[model samples]
Target chain A: MRYEEYNLEDLFLLAKKGDGTAFEHIVRQTEKQIYNLSLSIVKSNEDAEDLTQETYLRLWRSLPDYKGESAKSYIFRIARNLSIDLIRKRNRTPGSDTVILTADGEFERDIVDHDPDIRPDEAFIRRLTIETVRECISALPPPMRELIVMRDIDGLAYHEIASILEIPEGSVKSRLFRARERLRALIIEKNIL
Target chain B: MSKHSCKKYDFMIDDYIDGLLSDDDVRKLEAHLSTCEDCRQSLRFSIALRNMTRSAALEFPVGLHERIIESVNEDKKAKNVGSKRKIFRLGAISAACMLLCLCCTAVFLMLPGNRKSESKLPPDCPMSEAATDPSAMLPSFNGSVNAPEKGEDEGYTYPVIEEPALSSPEYDENSPEDAAPTPDETCAEPEEVAPNDKNDYEYSSTDAPANPAPDVMTNNSNISDRLENAADAEKSETHPVASPEGVPSARPGGEEITLALLIVSGLLAVASFIAFLISLSSIRTHSSNKENKK
Candidate 1:
């Protein structure tokens, strides 16, 4: 079955029961996201794979502990924990890739020039938007960086991000609000949005 | 539009981007944004940043799953093998220690003469006679002095005690040697007078010997006598005096050969056990660290 058909809890429960197929399907689904999260923190392809695998193994074992909550939030929680651990173990600074894209680099650089699925004109706009977005996100301090990641990249709701980050909803709102405002300025300055 | 005036909009910007505003909050925020061009610009920047971060995809390489599973399996196997090695090493060490004790006991036993033979010898005899014996000598010399006269005798005679090298030589031997004069040149004058007077003194005192070598001979005879005594004690199944001073010690003093065998075996066993333990611990610690990293 496609991993999309089953929620994270369903996949977790089945995998915990030693279902190799479910385990494989779950890995197939989440591996890319987990890998990306790990890569963002660790900044190494090999280490990212190792972190993703560890995340999956933990997900498999901890599936039985799922309490019928928001599957996306729960999975993101797991991913965040595993990614943080991997980064810490490697002793790498989070968002260390910030220097590669400077403030005005967004406007000067092409964005969707790297997109796997690209149309002719949309590619240029997508590329510019993406670069501006990446640059803007990179410029944020760690608190904002994490807030945006959970809310946008991982797609968790305000409550979900707050719970995962262990902050109040008000704080989440305030933090996200600042993060977005900063992004909008960067977009305007870069003229990509 | 002033930079100082933008502070009020700064705090609310993150919440606005996250869509956390209620209907009234949104209306108020929108109303503020509509009137404030600077706030509007700030809101747009926040939106762009969120969109960019969300869209960035961190890609994983191929075959990560199989590699991770393989690593875990290998680790578990290594741990299992390592534990068995540790157990084996521990067993070997205990066996070795016991064997070493046994061998030492046997070595002490097999030397039937021990200190009893020395007591039989003349008190004037320097302790270096054992090193001077021809059979115990090896061509690969360590520049050790074998002869010690009375003058040099104080520090030199018990070279075994002084040198440390002579006592526990690379080789082991137990044989008797000739008694020579002490290095004190002045003692040569007294030496001529002392032996004659010593014989008379011994005859008058011990009432056992009229001959010159009788004391030396008597000492050899006592070794056999002590051996016999040890045997009798063993026959009686009582603890025998192993020391020449008649201090009571471990039982079975006469069977040195048997004790030596036990000691060698015990020592070998102990060495193997210790090596095994070190190897196992190293492996375990290595694997445990690997597991932690994974």
Candidate 2:
């Protein structure tokens, strides 16, 4: 069954009874989405794991107060807040081996058009493309990284992305389109497409 | 016109995919998409990309679900444990305080009536424990020399007697002051006169008295020896120039007991002060950490 079909109250009702099995089911069901959301912010497995745990723990504690209808959104809200907090905390610690993505207005744009289908050893090329795409995403500035992740990976609507990121919907569309165009250019330049 | 006018609908394509448009807006978007090739191609790629992303979302580490559940359980257990510990600590502190209060009450009950008055010595101190010849004075229940013995020097005069065994010459050689007759001398004598009357006698330094001063005579020779020993106690008086400063000096056994008690009390005070400082620092540090956590 789709996780979204199961309302939060059902999970919360079972969880409040000190039911570990219910908690496990909840965690297993939400773990992928939560992990992906965390990874998009922290960009590290360990940090994502930590944020996911924090998100789950918060959800567990807040289950008693949950009104049930908006449970999925509630969990997402928790995950979002936790991810942001983890990022802020990471920035505050001194001597931390932080990887900061510095944004620059002097963006070098490349426009390229490649054939939609150029099957060049599907397995190897797909692996290399995936790795290179990850590297390119890592290289992007904070704004661009977030824009690309929201639009491409999470597949959020421009309005939803804008709301999540606290930017104008117009800004979200433009940035996402630009980010995609840039990724396409990099793929062509790196000869991965 | 349909092909050329559809460019405006491209911008709303993302909103339409997200299901945010009204029914009328959806009908308009569908009417535009039915003829716009470029818009349709863009929507197809966007949909494919969205599908790929949904399909490619990474799974978490195998045991993370179980681990999260374990952590939640552990956190609750730890909270319960912490609350129990807090209650236990409060109980322990209350028990300790009660015990301490009981002990202080017991100590107060055991103390003599005049404890506060005895704590402060005279501002102008004339004597220390080292200078006082304790063996000469009578026993006192408390350490203070200002307080009189339980009985006032009941009507009596103790006489001074010379000792033949330890001649004055040999005694003077051993002690710079004139020799006091040994305990055996005055222990045998008796006196019935009051102590105040004997205080009026001009103590004669000479050995002979033709009048045979009966007022100066006491049957207890040991008591006379005690008086003569106290005669050398002029310098050790805590307050000099008093009419009867010779009273309340320590006897041999009383001096030993008071000295031991003073030493033990001093050590206890020092240890308690050190422990109090350590506990204060620990509490301060703990409170600071709590503030930082907040």
Tens digit of per-residue lDDT, candidate 2, span B1-294: 344465467556656766767899899888877875656765664454345445545666777777788889888778557755655555455455545545555554455431333312233332222124434332211111222233343523234322222223344444435343344432322122233343445556473243344432342344445544553444323323223466864435644454455555555555555555565565566557547646
User: Which CAPRI category fits model 2?
Assistant: incorrect
> Across residues A69-126, which tens digit of lDDT does each residue of candidate 2 receive?
4444566668877877887877633122233432533234432433333322333334
What lDDT does model 2 reach? 0.55
Candidate 1 — which residues are off by over 4 angstroms? Answer: A1-4, A65-70, A94-129, A135-143, A178-193, B1-19, B59-294
The DockQ of predicted model 1 stands at 0.24
- For residue A102, give model 2's deviation from the true position in Å: 12
lDDT of 1 by residue, A17-135 (tens): 54556666666666666665555555557776777667766665577677777665666678778777765676666553332334432222222211212112323334455755666
Worst 10 residues of 2 chain B by lDDT: B138-147
Fnat per model, in the order shown: 0.47, 0.34
Residue by residue across B1-294, what tens digits does model 1's lDDT show? 555455665566666666655788778777788887756655654454456666765544667767756654565477568678677767767776776776676567557534233332234533222222322222122323334334442432211111212233342233212222334421211112111223333344353343243343343344335434434433233322334456655645445555566667667767777776777786678667657646
Best-performing candidate as measured by TM-score: 2
TM-score of 1: 0.41
**lDDT value, residue B55 of candidate 1:** 74
